[model samples]
Target: MLIEHLTMEEFAAGLERTRTVLVPFGSTEEHGSHLPLDTDTMQAIDVGRALARQRPIFIAPPVHYGVCRSTFDHPGTLSISTETLKALTIDIVAALYRQGLRYFILLSGHAGGTHMATLTDAGEVLLQRYPELRIAVVSEYQLAAESGRELIETAGDSHAGEIETSRIMHARPELVKGTAPAEYPAFPKGLLVRDKRRFWPGGVWGDPGKASAEKGARIEALVVRELRTLVEQLEAWQDS
Candidate 1:
């Protein structure tokens, strides 16, 4: 069930049954030229809803802002500071912690390294504060990347790539325009530049030409399965 849609009485009843909550995070950032800016958010919410069908958990309202460094100059990309994202995550989880929820899965659709790191840091902070808390910071992208490695046709498919495009195609086809040409950014390794878009003009990191709804459905199912397994393990955690 989604926490945002639950009434106080319904929330209380849910708490009596389960303390597990899945908090999905995504970015209001660009996803190449074809896909919607909220692609990450949409995919995260999709996974949460899919997982909920097979398990008992509350889905928190997704965090739509993330610290987007590479896509900062891209159109429709709205980024918050790294500190802000971290603090927001900590505050949200802290609020949930006080509400009798103990198990948390911080699932982010935006899998940027910095964004994931900030979430991991927040999970650590929550754990430090509430030792009984059972938390996991993860991204369905991690599972999709691993599980769909063989199914994907594109090399180094990451952002706005075959996999992501396919997932969006399966989940929200109406939001997609025609597919954009495959592109790989040439950002300087171990260096920072102000003109991020110049190095990656198209804002695509992999081939979108190979994306298909069939592949997307399979990948999404795989990710949901892996997440279910993760939740089962988290639920079995016992204080030592």
Candidate 2:
């Protein structure tokens, strides 16, 4: 269930049963000219909600803004520094740990380098600080792979590509501009490309023209299935 909608009493009662909280992290950046700026947030929320239905989990409100330096060249893309992102994550995790929540599963929807790197570092620190707490970072692509690779056309190139575009089309069809001319920008070779210094110019790395609602539904199904497996694994570990 969504943590923000619960009353204090309700949340307290929930803590008695389980201390795990799932955080959906996303970015408010350009998802090409076709998809909405909130595409990452929306997809993350959708997956989080689906997972909550089959398990006793609390879904935190999405972190809608994240590091998107590569997309900063595009208008309307909001990005934060790596330091800021790292600090914010540590603070949030520490607060949750104080609140008696021991498990924090971060479901990140952004592919930005700085954001992911900061989260990885923060997760490591939080784990060391609170050994009793369990933390897991769920990558949508990884989850999808566990189910099946056929769900995605181009495995590595996911941004605004067939998989992501289809996902947005399935989750938020109205927000997708189906008429936009699709293009797949190439990445330069031999560069230590971080999120801030990407090779692509237009923020689009794959061809989004193949995106369709049908494909999107398939992708969503795979994500949900894999998430169910992850939750079950967590439950088993807790029981053990």
Candidate 3:
């Protein structure tokens, strides 16, 4: 159920029966020319809602800002430091844990390297403080990358490419407009610090034109199925 819609008593009752909480985490970043800035957030909430339909869980409001330093140069990309993200995440977990929620599934839709690292580190700190709590943070795209590789024909599914575009098409078709032209800009082989704008000039890494609502539906189903397995794994740890 959506936590925001629940009254305090209802929420407490939900917590009493349901040990797991699903937190949709996303980013406000430029998603090429076709998709909207809230693409990640929309996709994340979709996943959370789908998962909640299959299991009894509290769906927390989505986290919209994330670590996007690489893409910050692109207009409309909102970013926060890794440390800030870590602290915010830890605080959120602590607050929820106080409500008797023992399991947290941070369903991230963003793929920033620092973002993922910060989430993992925050979960670690939460576990240290509350040894009884169990947390799992992961991205739906990463989970589908292994099995849905064939579905992606764009340069790559890293950014607002085929997979992401398709996901949006399936979730919210009216939001999509003309797509950015496909370009495969490569970065320096040995560069330690690279600029996303230089490597991906179009702000698009893959061919979004290749995306279709049919493919998007397929991808969404695949991600949800994989996430269900992950949630089950987390649930298994609740009583241990």
lDDT of each: 0.91, 0.77, 0.84
* Local accuracy of candidate 1 as per-residue lDDT tens digits, 15-59: 988999999899999999999999999889999999998878899
lDDT of 1: 0.91
- What TM-score would each prediction reach against the true structure? 0.98, 0.89, 0.94
Model 3: what TM-score? 0.94
Model 2 residue 172 lDDT?
81
Query: Comparing candidate 1 with candidate 2, which one achieves the higher TM-score?
Result: 1
> How many residue pairs clash per model?
0, 0, 0
Query: Model 3, residue 129: what's the lDDT?
Result: 90
Better of 1 and 3 by lDDT: 1
Model 1: number of backbone collisions: 0
- Residues 1-240, candidate 2: write the lDDT tens digits: 698899989989989878888888888888777888888888888988987888788888789888886677676788888888888888988987887888788878886666787888989998788868788877665565456476556646567777778888888888888734445655556554565324555556666776678988887888887877776565456522
Q: lDDT (0-100) at residue 4 of candidate 2?
A: 89
* Rank list by TM-score: 1, 3, 2
